[model samples]
Target: MESLQKSLLVTGGAGFIGANFVHYWLNTYPNDKVTVLDALTYAGNKENLASLEGSSNFKFVHGNICDQDLVEQLLQSGEINTIVHFAAESHVDRSITGPDEFIETNIIGTYSLLKAAKKVWLDIPKEQGRQALEHRFHHVSTDEVYGTLELRDPAFTEDTAYAPNSPYSASKAASDHLVRAYHHTYGLEVTTSNCSNNYGPYHFPEKLIPLIVTNILHDKPLPIYGDGKQVRDWLYVEDHARGIDLVLNKGRVGENYNIGGHNEWHNIDIVKLICQLMDQAFENDKTLIEKYPLAILARQAKSEELITYVTDRAGHDRRYAIDAEKSFTELGYRPQESFETGIRKTIEWYLDNDSWWRSLIK
Candidate 1:
């Protein structure tokens, strides 16, 4: 690939995975310009990108992807050659309760962006068509679209037929199909990556790792749904960010990639591990034990006692694992953080960045 100058637009850049990607991209390509368009919803926090406020190469725009005018205006600037689409209603539980937002954002929002990209980047300027070919619309997706797997079944590969069970995954599945269709029909350059569960800094507290960590800190119940045996492959957020970078730059056009940590753990096991880690942290660090009065009491009383089993979520999948061999072999991409190392880093981040998460919790 030739070294062409890149001006990128990253959607959902205020959210967990997207913020990490924004940080990673700027650091990796310091000279390149990046425009971040985020809706700043409940899940998207401006504090996540607070560090990049003064950088000349970074610009943040508060907007929704579903707004065709806003999306078109950004693309028409003729600066964004790469569009990393991460905006979506991703929580399965929320999707079940009210699927309207999921459909609006995940399905319709994606179509709007694709349409805008096709028109602004591809449809106009017949003489500059070659330059347009270099523009990439990279769709960041999830592994849930493959549905659940049996305990003994193989992990989902890039070729796995999408069998989305929940509204969240179904909407994502629809968006994924739209991306591929645009590539095949309009010849718009596009690449898609379906990643497993991501855990790391700036993670919303509603997810598994953050929820368990926060609950343990406050001496609250660690709620486990069903038997808590639902297995999910967990990828560290930074590693997923790197994988996205790889796919954007080197992945084959009109192709999809599976990005995973290759580390699968049951939900209950993850909660238990967080409890054990918290216990150890409390024992080793007197300051932590002193900082949170509730945690100190819980440490003395036994943190594991807080575990509570709740009813399973509606239409919950039993397991999800991704086979990322193709990405590893083709794009020279591999996760650097093991589950143990990643979890420790995540816990440490939460311990140190109390204000960052506390504000969100309130």
Candidate 2:
């Protein structure tokens, strides 16, 4: 596929996966312009995009996606041809505790973006609509919208029925439906990708991987909810970003794609792997190990002892896996990082960038 000149608006570009995509998009297409609209919520950190602060190709706008006036203004500036919507309240635990934000951000925010896109891209004349034909709205979503899979059930496919279990997943499912409805009803050029669990640099410590890494560093108990047997298909964040790029450029409009690593691991297994890696790192460099408090160092030396089980999360899914064959067959997409390589890299990133995450912790 020929590369099109893309001036993109990346919503929620300050959050974990969104921030990574902003960096990825700028590096991959240096000639393209990117404007990031982020609300700077707790999960959205301006520092995530600090490196791109002065880049000519990048601009960061502080705003909410639900603000229809702001979204329409940005789109009508005629500078943006693509809207990559990523802003959402994505944590399941937080959704259980407080679901209002999930509905407002995930459902209402997505509706606002879609409505604005329709007005800006579809409500114009034939001659002037050439740019609209080239314009695309790419929605990034999660696989949990398909709900859990039994131990022997097949991985989720693009055609899988929506059975969202938590408020977070349900909100995403609603947003997905809205995107599809807009595409079919309004003739809007849109594509959606439901990706598996993503882990990499800039991941907040609240999630499993970074949480375990941080907990181990501090010699705190590694809290495992329930039996830690819940399964998730793990995709490296960069690979997911690459998949998004492929789908945005090459995928058929009005279609949905599934992006995953084809790597499924039990929650406990991932924690244990981090512990083992930490142990090895500490053993290899005693001086590095000494940087931690003495008690932390002692605990880090025997990382497994820190494992502790807690009550399970509400509506915890037993397993989630994705069948990304459609992406591979249609878009020539394939993950570059294996779990072993990706996990090691993620751990090293957290270790090397202490201040980056420490600030978040504070």
Candidate 3:
């Protein structure tokens, strides 16, 4: 790889936000090449990036970030000039069931990447090494790091103290610390973006939005944790990709940016909204009425009927809202879609792309 071309190695590019960022950056920066390294875990599906299969500037590598040898090789031998690390075990419910993978991948893997970067960067040729040092290592993270907030409190700002409540969040916080430590101790050029809940097309099925959509499609009971009052700031996936681009291309190194839309909705509200949208979409589609008569039988089926409260998620955070004012005022960053518009687009995408989701089940 040629460093002059600004190649980026995006870890976990097959996952949800990672895939979005990969597509976003490749299209946004046509001159740059992006190499995606994903372990292809249950959550990491290659189909997400199938759209970029033949592009000259895009390539995918299946691997874990913890592989030191592979990490070192990619750093030393690629035209790789940037790294946007998005690989991690992200689901809090899964983390509660099994937390070991989160520790291994999020924390240790981040350390491995940071170590590789340090080894590659320590020996500068001195004549003109500063330009190469400008290469950015952008860390894609979650706003869950700041834990929950009271309803009346301010949203999480960059200065908000870390208060993780779950295994998943703890692992992410550990990784964030490692990233910050690497920047401070070894002078690695790094920027971190902690974001809110991301919902859009291509999302894996286990998460809230996708899970509900899939369950509704199957006419199964839609499960809601607790009373479904957990408040979360929702940001569109592509908007997140745009924020990542701004942070990677022009952000100040060693800075942390919160990326999220100001839109906040409780979990139940979101699920209800999904049901309403699905009802509207289904009513409009004559084929849906013919394909599934239950949908027509319950023409007035309220979205709320699907809601069933299960046991509250263990270690569930009460609320997470990001104050993206830094990303907004500083980087000239702004999301093009509001939550309403973004959700509608997402619902439409899922309806149009049936086979894409079906293929992922196996």
Please report how far candidate 2 places residue 15 from its true position, in Å: 0.4
Q: Superpose all Cα atoms of candidate 3 onto the true structure and report the RMSD in Å to 1 decimal.
A: 2.6
**Runs of candidate 2 exceeding 4 Å displacement:** 126-133, 294-300
Predicted candidate 3 versus true structure: per-residue lDDT over 1-362, tens digit per residue: 12245778999999999998888887877987889999999889899999899999888888889997898788667747788999999999889999999999999999999887776655442444653444678898899999899988899999999989999999999999999998898778889999999999889988888877766776667898888999999999999999987887668889999999998999999999999988887777767656545543224555557678899977788889999999999889999999889989988887778787866643
Model 1 TM-score relative to the real fold: 0.97
Model 2 pairs whose backbones collide: none
Pairs in steric clash, model 3 = 1-79, 2-79
Better of 1 and 3 by TM-score: 1
Model 2 per-residue lDDT tens digits across residues 19-55: 9999999899999999999999999999999999888
Worst 10 residues of 1 by lDDT: 125-134
RMSD of each: 1.5, 1.7, 2.6
RMSD of model 1 against the true structure: 1.5
TM-score of 2: 0.96
> Cα lDDT of all candidates, in order?
0.91, 0.91, 0.85
User: Residue 340 of model 3: what lDDT?
Assistant: 89
lDDT of 1 by residue, 1-362 (tens): 22778888999999999999999999999998889999999999999999999999999999999898898898767468899999998999999999999999999999999998998877775556555546889999999999999999999999899999999999999999999999999989999999999999999999989998888888788999999999999999999999988887788998999999889999999988888888888888888877777785356747788899999989999999999999999999989999999999999999999988887773
For each candidate in turn, the TM-score is: 0.97, 0.96, 0.94
